[model samples]
Target: MTKFADIKGFVFDLDGVITDTSILHGTAWHQLADSLGVTWTKELGDGLKGISRMDSLEMILKAGHKENDYTQAQKEELAAQKNTNYVAEVDKMTPANILPGMKAFLDDLRAKGYQLSLASASKNAPRVLGKLGLTDYFPKIVDPASLKHGKPDPEIYTKGAELLNLDPAQCIGLEDAAAGVQAINGAGETSLGIGDATELGAADMVFADTSAVTLANIAKHLD
Candidate 1:
């Protein structure tokens, strides 16, 4: 068992965990698919969560039967276009875009002396954090540009721990996606899932939402 007090750092996922920008991302993806004449569905949008933009675009291309039609450069261009759309949406974000209880939870953790880092698959993570007025809260931000591989690869989470100068075992990774939970566990850190239990079964512990996350609940892991 690991105690919250024993945790030296906290790594958070940006999109679903810190904010509800997943919908904006999905909208961008859907719009991209529409322009490409590809059929898009909610199920496909779910697959994009926690994945890198290039990977998501690959998935979309494969689903659209255009994987072989585009060269790597073309794919990159399409991915960039998707990012432009997503960024347009994110630019409109404000502090109110942060999820319920997230600000207070982060403040509480900071007060307790826990180092914080943001490990997000989004290249726009810094922009989003700035829009939410949370840029100062995380001194270490491992975004898509910093990652060679995305979630479920564990590189991002491990990099986050490295940036905090803490061992993976000394950190707690908080996420709201199944792939992210797997990445956290794969990094040898404690996993705190922030969504559906069944969806995030790989997590060491699960909370239904940010409001359910508390120092006491996390400390109980020490037992």
Candidate 2:
């Protein structure tokens, strides 16, 4: 396997990776399922990895029944509800929910002269980072609001590279979703899949979770 030690920086996906919000996402998604009279199975939920909440909603509509679909307005409404519920859930997420080892990893990467940034499909990325005191770790944040499309399009990942003034191939993207992995792959960058390993088997490599993404692992990737 080709090691990507030559990469100059690291980009991260929020929510599941940094904020431990996957369960909350599932909660909101299952809520939508209830309203639609469909069940949000774990496998179906895992399939939504790396996709934006809006995209996930679209997927949910299809996964729920494939016949009943979400209109643009309803899509917006579902996204809004998820955001609302997520914020409320994390309003209490002071230091507990932030993944273990994230701070140390960020510090080590910054110390290693690697530029750090974030690319999340979540619309409330800025706010979520602020709540966890993680905003200072990454100055550049690419979210759904800044793009015409979400994950699996590479636009967000490409935009993050643009903001960093780096080429996509020169960076590594840390993501927890299948969509996130696909996005970085489409962007032509080295993608290190984090969060749930089963859902990210298609990635170049799958770590146990954010806690497993250490400087040691980063060093291994450094060519």
Candidate 3:
């Protein structure tokens, strides 16, 4: 574990990595698209992952060929409505909603004294964590509102390391989205992707799911 010795913290992305909120997010965006008379597609839904709410809205608008149709204030109103829809579902989350093996993995990380911080683009990260009874696991959560840039720009992960008082080199970033893995790599942290190997090939390591993200398994890849 010599190569892992310097690792002091873990920065996590909340959506697919921590739990599955894609349905909630998709439903919200789908409803908004329908209201605006825009057609929704699977490809459009996939593009929203690991991105900020505003960015997601813009993407949806572009997909509908209505990018210039809404004023800035109107766009904000639409985004807010989308959030309202997402939050209604998020409020229903419970500990049971925590992904399989994730609680055990978090417990292992904590027992080993590895600091944890969240770098989710979602503004509702705290509420989701609270609902899932996992708020205390992450002492620091980078507020998306404070960032000038989102995932794949490195700002969020860099700030997460900063909040832990650690250098990017001393942290491992866990994510399940391509943009998030890019953000981790861009931040100079060890990147671990928790999904399909082909989609996440850029990461330093890839796990099929949370069940395989054990500390021992992580040690093997750190070297």
Candidate 4:
């Protein structure tokens, strides 16, 4: 089995993996949809996971059958408005909001001399990290604004590896979204899915949730 000892760096997805801000994002989306008189559902919220804000807005628009109704500027405005709501929710976050075992796991990785980076589609990654008191754990944050494409594109994960000065194969990527798992796999790295196995079949291994993921379990995947 591959051991955690073999992994030189760790690349993490922010929202669902490191924290539970997915609900806040979903709530913002619902508010936006409600304002537009569009019926938003939990199924649609699932689609927004690991995707960019503009893309999520586009999906909402498409779902509402109003995709072409808005100009590019209008779409940008709508995305910004939703971000305002999401940011407000984020501002209320505390370190306690971080997933169980996450802080300790990060500490363990740091003590083992592994570099860490965050590769998230959220433009507010830094803000969220700051809110959760996790900004210090990740030295390298792959900015969403720097990427031309989002999750499922491999660009973010690849960039994360680059920032950590490690090869993709030498890094372990953790995510709670299928698109993120696909992106990690596409980048030729090992993927540890942090959610339901059925939703993350592309991952090399799956954990039921962040609380279930342990350093020992990560090491087992290194093989």
Root-mean-square deviation (CA) per prediction: 2.4, 4.0, 2.5, 2.5
Ranking by lDDT: 3, 1, 4, 2
Per-residue alpha-carbon lDDT of candidate 2 for residues 1-223, written as tens digits (9 for 90 to 100): 4456667878888866777777777776777677777776889878775455667877877776653565678778777887777678767667566888887788888887888888876666777788788877888887566689777889988988887899888888888778889999999888888857688877876778677888677656555
Error of 2 at 221 (Å): 4.3
**Which residue pairs clash in candidate 2?**
5-221, 5-222, 5-223, 50-177, 50-180
* Residue 2, model 1: Cα distance from true site in angstroms: 1.9
Q: lDDT (0-100) at residue 54 of candidate 2?
A: 69
**What's each prediction's clash count?**
0, 5, 0, 4
Cα TM-score per model:
0.86, 0.75, 0.87, 0.86
User: What is the per-residue lDDT of model 4 for residues 183-221, given as tens digits with 9 covering 90 to 100?
Assistant: 999998889999889999888899997877877877666
Q: Residue 138: error of model 3 in Å?
A: 0.9
lDDT of each: 0.89, 0.77, 0.91, 0.87
Clashes of 2: 5
Model 4: ten consecutive residues of lowest lDDT: 1-10
What is the TM-score (0 to 1) of candidate 2? 0.75
> Candidate 4 at residue 88, lDDT?
93
Name the candidate that leads on TM-score. 3
